[model samples]
Target: MLTPSVEALIQHLADGKFHSGKKLADTLQTSRTTVWKSVQSLQALGLEIQAVKGRGYRLTHPWERLNAEQITASIQVPEACPPPVVEVHDCLNSTNAHLLRTASLRPAASICLAEMQTAGRGRLGRNWVSPFGANIYLSLLWRFRRGESLGGLSLAVGVETVRVLRTLGLADLRLKWPNDILWQERKLGGILIEAITESQGQCVVVVGLGLNLRLPPGAADAIDQPWVDIRTILGGGSSRSDLAVPSRNRMAGDLSSRLLALLNAYGSEGLTPWLEDWRRWNCVLGRRVTVDEIGQRYEATAVNVTEEGSLVLRRDDGRRRLLAAGDVRLRVRHDA
Candidate 1:
């Protein structure tokens, strides 16, 4: 359960800086033995702690909370839309779920950020592993007029997210159709868009995003898919580029600024503006993939993706595209 003392201990070690045992004990108002026990509990949770005989203990990497002031300062908003206030929580069942319940009362671009999530979710009800202070878990509320075509909104969100990631010096990135952000064909992050249509031509959409920044060894054991994080991409020295992942606050701020700009444009322009980007980053196009839909499964070569968000497949029998809004799983094996 990570009692308050343990959480307090974490705040002290968050910046990748070592705190001596004596200092930690004094700060937490506990004895050295109790502080050591608390550190063990955190290690038990799969967080890597580097303890030296002389230097003390620190996290494997720096972790930062979602800072509201830093986020708003970095966001460049249009004159019409003020920077949405961020609701930062230490933990929540799901940022998306919480915003869905309250989006009706909030204006567009309202953001929800969390340090950790208990029941974080991805598309099609898969659990999104959310270890504390290790990744990005954000939900933003956007509304559209009832008649607006929501056809490619989810994919467009992916495009916007990838745009932000690219600006952050991420390379070899790809966008899987629907809502996945991929780096070298491995899942890096995802976008989930939930919509509620009212009786009076109003629609409320909650867009949730989860990106791995610094996942610990055992924290993501439940994830069935091959996942990659920002540190894994750049920090691993696999890439020759000098890119580095920014602090959590800056990452959140960059993502928020770009995504909000997207909501403002996507509502009116539809997917026309993002089609060019889709062609550049889509990993599904010209790739062999298996599609599972409603108990039927088939393999096909993806030929195209329409602006309406249809997946065009070239099968041995004939060419077809899926346009229905339902459970669609594209099992794409990485060969390219």
Candidate 2:
């Protein structure tokens, strides 16, 4: 949680320049001791604050805070969809939870972004690691007057997200079945979709996304699976060394705009148009894998994904099964 004083201090130091404690205190109308304590708190939030006796304090690396204005400006609303309402927060428990709670009051294309999440979540109730100002934690609300099945919404979202990232020059990205983005078999990001239908046949959907821009060391320690961030990918190799890494604000704007465009396209055409794209990016297609469903594990050959985004598996006995939901894992040769 960021206090008002800390928020004020961050604004003053956001330029990546040194500001004396006395100067900050004077500007914020607080005591120097308070300024000192606030700086400590900022450092605790994974921000590298360099404190020198002569230079005072400044963020070690450039930190770009999320700007609602910049995000709004970057969005291009189509004639069929309403202009999005963008909101940025210093901290939130969960952006999806917030939108779900207030879905009835908000219109379509409503978006919420957070710098830090206290209770960030992923599919199947997994804890999403979110450090302050280090990654993208966003949720957007879309409404439909006539209810739609939304059977393949998550896969469509993944396809759009991959397209946006690839446009930004990140390579070797792939999509995992259901709701995951991967780079070289390691998780890079994920999508979570929540929906509720009203009695009148209107449905409201909340699409939540978490992408790792620069995961702090401590935050990465909590993740059980192998994962990678955009920074490491862009910073590696001769080919990508010249690529310019985008600021968080810019990335947010790009992602939001692309996602809105995707929503509009999906509304018109459904998941059929995106099925080929999803198949092209499917990382585990044709691999021997196991799907854990309700305490039973089904090991089979992944044949292909259905148009509705269900996994089509070929069992040992020449039987084919279409699974809607399960935890999927690649089966090694030793396991067979």
For model 1 the local lDDT of residue 323 reads 38
Return the TM-score for each candidate structure. 0.91, 0.91
lDDT of 1 by residue, 203-222 (tens): 99888999998787788677
Best by lDDT: 2
- Model 2 residue 36 CA deviation (Å) reads 1.4
Off by over 4 Å in 2: 20-29, 145-147, 237-243, 326-336
lDDT of 2 at 165: 92
Cα lDDT of all candidates, in order?
0.83, 0.84
